[model samples]
Target: MFERFTKPARAAVVQSQVEARRLGHDRIDDSHLLLGVLAQEAGVGARVLTELGVGLDAARDAVAALHAPDAQALGALGIDLDEVRRKAEAAFGEGALERRFARRRGFFRRSTGHIAFTRPAKAALEDALRQALTLRHNYIGTEHLVLGLLTGGSSTAGRVLHRLGVRVDAAELRRRVLDELGRAA
Candidate 1:
């Protein structure tokens, strides 16, 4: 999954994990993943979210709303938050001990390493990269990344983007990308 990510994208995942640890979060959630995606600063996913006015706080709020105990909030949301946490730990390594040390020292860990990503986010990134490869794109485009985010299926990010009016129809986005590339050429 990590192999498909651009260096910046990978860094963003790492950055999110580190940020979560600094915040004393035990699990890497979708909110953390969205923040990490934003931290990348140069991906289509980030740009699309930003253009749709989806800020980090807004994304966090959206996630929190869905996290309610009410099962009726979303029918068949189908995400195992615990599994997501485990995947994050596997991908980015556990930070519980490191975070504790930083807290004790009255310092925050801002150094970037292999920070974890929530499972949905990881799946989204991987799917997006796979789509890009299928299309024979030399570089992963923002649209590709956005589509990847969508592929995670019923995610906080997907729901929030829909509510914010960011449409990500794969064919349309791909056409736009091709058009832009053609114009550039």
Candidate 2:
């Protein structure tokens, strides 16, 4: 199945793990896959997302927003998340508390290496192959990857893309990607 992936598609898969690590996530979810798609600037999926104003940084920020720690939930445990956030911000500057793993001294304690892909992520990759087959494409490309994200409808990546697209919902994005592929063909 990997043999069917094009260069850009393979890059997206590898980069998904990189994005997960950068975001302090142990698992690569569909959102990370979306970042992988956005990272491939020359790929059609990347270009289409960029045209819709969804760049890599913006996508990263969205991922961060989605994964923000729940202060109320933490407060229930008597942790006083707000106070911790304030002190951490004062000592480490802004957004220090927002990160998943905190650094002690110079070392990050969390496992920064070997990120596993979540079930949804694996499903998306499998769906990418299905998308390529449906389109009668010889190789799976980044465009198919974008379609794979949308196939799940309520997936993390689909929701993020829809939110990022603003006026254009996930379905619209799916259409635009397919249309762009058609034009390139």
Which candidate comes out best when scored by TM-score? Answer: 2
Q: What is the lDDT of residue 62 in candidate 2?
A: 87
19-114, model 1: which lDDT tens digit per residue? 566555555655566666776656665665676577766665555555445544334587665565578778778853234322327776554444
Runs with alpha carbons beyond 4 Å of true place in candidate 2: 76-78, 82-113, 167-171
Error of 1 at 142 (Å): 5.6
TM-score for candidate 2, please give it.
0.78
Candidate 1 Cα RMSD (Å): 10.1
Clashing pairs in 1: 44-142
C-alpha lDDT (0 to 100) for residue 123 of candidate 2: 94
Those runs of model 1 whose alpha carbons end farther than 4 Å from true positions after fitting are 1-4, 19-25, 29-31, 68-118, 138-143, 165-168, 173-185
* Clashes by residue pair, model 2: none
| C-alpha lDDT of residue 113 in model 1 | 40
lDDT of each: 0.62, 0.84
